[model samples]
Each structure stands twice: as C-alpha cells, then as structure tokens.
Target: MDDVKPKVVVDPSAGFCTGVKRAIATTEKVLEGDGEVFCLGELVHNEAELERLNHLGMKILDKNHLSRTTIGSHVLVRAHGEPPETYKVLEDKSVKITDATCPVVLRLQQKVKKASEEMQASGGSVIIFGKASHAEVIGLLGNTKGKAYAINKKEQLDSIDFSKPIRVFSQTTSDQNEYEDICNQIRIKSSNLSNGNPDIEINNTICGQVSRRGPALEIFARSHDVVIFVSGSESSNGKYLAGLCKSANPLTYTVTGTGQINPEWVLNAKSVGVSGATSTPEWLMLKVAAEIEAMI
Candidate 1:
C-alpha cells in the first residue's frame, strides 16, 4: 500500500506587508548601483533575507560606523523610521539619504510630533502604546523631544498623569485588540481622575493591513491540522502572529525558513498550513510549502 501525503496550503495573506515591501524594493534598487549604500538598521527582520542582501554587497551601518561615514555617502532608512536625530546626524555628515519610511508611519510620526507639541504646551502627556525600545517608538519619542511616555502594556499606564490632557497613539504594528483594550482602560482611568471629565484623545494609529491580519490569520491557522509559521527570530510581528496561529492550532510550529521544517510535522497531518510574518518574503513561504510537499 502507498503512504498518504498531507496537503499543504500556504496562507495567501501571509508575508511582506505593504510597508516592508516598499522598503525592500527601494533597497534593491539602491543595491543595483555599484556605489556603496548603507542601511541604518536591519532592512528587514529576516536573517536569511539579510544574508542575501549582504551577499549582494549591502553594508549595514550601526552607530559604530557613523563616524566613518563620509560626506556624499548614501544611507538607506528601513521601513522602521528612525528618530529625527538620526536624520540630523546624517545631515550633519552631509550624507545622501534614501528615506524609505512607510507612508503610514511617516503620517503617524507627523501626527505624534504635533501631539507632542500640543501636550508640551498644555502640561499634559503624549502616550505611545508600544514597546519602549522598538525602533518605531524611539522615532516617535524623538518627535516629542524625548518628553513622550511609552507604555508596553496597559499596566504601565499607572506611570502616566491622567489629570492632565492626554493623547494616545499606537505603533503601526501593535496588536489591534490589545490597543483597543488599553484605550478603554485609559478612558476609565481618566474619567475617575478628572471627575468624569476625561480629557483624553485616542487615535487609532495602527496600520489597517496589520490590524486586519489577526482575524484572517486566525482563520487560516484553524483550517488545517498543522500550521508552520515562518519568520525571523528578530521580528516582533512574527512572534505575535505565530502566537495567534498556535492559539488556533495546537500543532503550530515556528521556523525562520524551510531548513527548519521537521518531517514529523507532516508525518501525521492530513493538511498543513504555511504562514509567515509581515517581514517575511513570499518566496520563502512558497519554498516552505514545496519542502513540506517533498516530505509528505
């Protein structure tokens, strides 16, 4: 008797959000030039993709390399926009810059900057609901001249002074459901602190594409018996989405690429789903699907 092979389905919605694709496409165009170009940060969170760029002669310029930068040298900003100071530093060096900031993030930064200015004059607070150390948050803080407060979770809101007027903004990639919950709690806290006069402003700043992904991904995760979530270790978006898959399917497993797929994952499954993060390349997902096909 012939052995049965599990059917594998790759999530059509997975891989390369609009912002990341724009950033990478910009980088690739620069790479085509023979002259050197420096990327300020990991262009994307995937190690395999990074390695591919490196092989193509991409140079990454960390802070240590800043001083070595010469005038007229080209530098690229990834989708994760940097703080204003980064631009100032590059400008001071007279370096040419290709800013590939996501248009959505650019708008968010502008909004945060304006809100920061307003809050500074009002003696209120500008609250950013995001990881404090994330590059995007760091950039947002720069807009506020380092005066804005960043909160990773709702519990951190205790540190905020709700008596004053408050403006809340969320990172583009943060979980939408969690951000809603945090805003609700903020409203409750502000009402109690201000005698039911909650002087609070909540802006839904999360990118629409990312906000919509969770629901779609959850559905994809449950449609098959086994789900393989592909993403680099460094991507927070990947981590969040992979967790969503795991919640929907107990057989979910995470890997950065096809190399990490295990034969056991497909040995017992009648159907498998391949999914990935916003930073993941579509080609990688297809490869993972092909590898699983070979195994089962």
Candidate 2:
C-alpha cells in the first residue's frame, strides 16, 4: 500500500509583525549604505534571518560587546526598544544610531515613563507586569529609573504593598490573560486595603500585534489536521502561539527550525498547517513548509 501525503496550510499572520517589519526594513535600508552597521541585538528573534543578515555584513552586538566596540560606528536599535540612557551612551561614544524601535513599544515606554513620573511626584510606587530579565522589561524599567518592580506571575503580585498607591504597566509582548489576571489581583488587593479604595492604576500596554495572535492562531489551528509552529525558543510570543496551536489541535508541534520536524507527527494527517510568531521570518516558514512537503 502507498502512503498518503499531508497537505500544508500556512497561517496568514505567521511571520513578522509591524514592529519587526519596520526593523527589517530599516536594517535592509542600512545595508544598502556603505557603513558597517551593527544591531544592538538580533534584529528579530529568528536566527535564520539573523544569519542571512549577517551574511550581508550586518553585525549583532550584545550590551557588553557594544561597550567594547570602537566609537563613531553605526548601531541600530532592535524592535525591543532600548532605554533612553542606551541612546545617551551611544551618543557619548559618538556612535551614529539608527533607531528601529517598534512604534508600539516606543509608545508603551513613553506611557510607562510618564506614569512613573506621575507616581514619583505623588509619592507612589510603580509596578510593571512582565518578565524580569526580558529586554523589553529592562527597557520599561529604564523609564522608571530602575525603580519599577517586575512581576511575571500572579504570585509576584503579593510583593506589591497595597498601603501605597500603585501605577502599573505591562511589557508589549506579555500574555494578555496573564496581564489581566495580574490586574485583577492588584485590584482585589487594593480594594481590600485603604477602606475599599481602588487606588491601583493598571495600564493595558500590551501591543495589539502580539495580543491579536492568540485568537488568530485559534482560528487557524482548527483548519488543519496537524500544525507546525516555527519560531525561536527565546520568543515568549512564539511559545504562546505554539501553546495556542497545541490547545486547538492536539497534533500540533513546535519546532525551532525545519530540521526539527519529525516525520511521524504528520503521518496520517491530510492538512498540515504552519505558523510562527511575530519574530519569525516568512522565509523560515516557507522552509518549514518545504520540509513538510518534502517529507510527504
């Protein structure tokens, strides 16, 4: 008997988001120029795309590495958006800076900074709902002069003192539901104290580009028999999208690259779908699709 091949359907929103799009466009434009351009971090989370850019003479610079590099060179900020002081450091070094910070993240940073200033002026504290060590989280903390408390989970809410007025904001890519849960907990905590006054101000600063993926992934997942989620392991949104796919279709598999695809996963499936996070590249997804087709 002959084996049947699986059909592959790619998600419409599988690749780069608006922020990543802007960053890539800026990088490509810079590549057209004659200078040695360095990105503060990976322009996007996809390693394959980064390698491709690397071949084009784009260099990835870590924070420590950046400090050691010669001054007056060109440096492009990634979509994650760096703290204001980062730009100051580059300026002091006479580095020509190309800022590709996502407009949404830039706005979020401004909002957080403004809120923090207000809180500080009123003698209150600022709480940030996000991963502690994430680049975006660090950027958010920078707005508050490193005085913000970063909370990743609901349990972290316990550390906030309800006795004091609180101002809160979320990382641009944080889980929306988790942000809501944190806000609810904070509200409850605030209500319980200070004679039932809800003094906590929670700002929903999560980017719509990232948050919209959840529902879109759910819809896309149901249309296929097996789903392949392609994204970098370091991307939180990538992990979330994979979970959404798995929850929608038990046959879903998350792979960093096409090489990780197991032939057995699609073994009896007719329609196999492919999707990825905002940080993923369209070429990478196409590669994964090609790999799936080749297996079939």
RMSD of every prediction: 1.6, 1.7
What are the lDDT figures for the candidates, one per model? 0.88, 0.85
Off by over 4 Å in 1: 1-4
Q: Show the lowest summed lDDT stretch of 10 residues, model 1.
A: 190-199
lDDT of 1 by residue, 22-56 (tens): 99888888878854689987888998888888888
TM-score of each: 0.95, 0.95
Question: What's the distance in Å from true for residue 80, model 1?
Answer: 0.7
Error of 2 at 27 (Å): 0.7
Candidate 2 residue-wise lDDT at 124? 73
lDDT of 2 by residue, 21-106 (tens): 88988988888893468899778888888888898879989987767667767899998999888988898888888999999988
Best-fitting candidate, measured by lDDT? 1
Candidate 2: which stretches are off by over 4 Å? 1-5
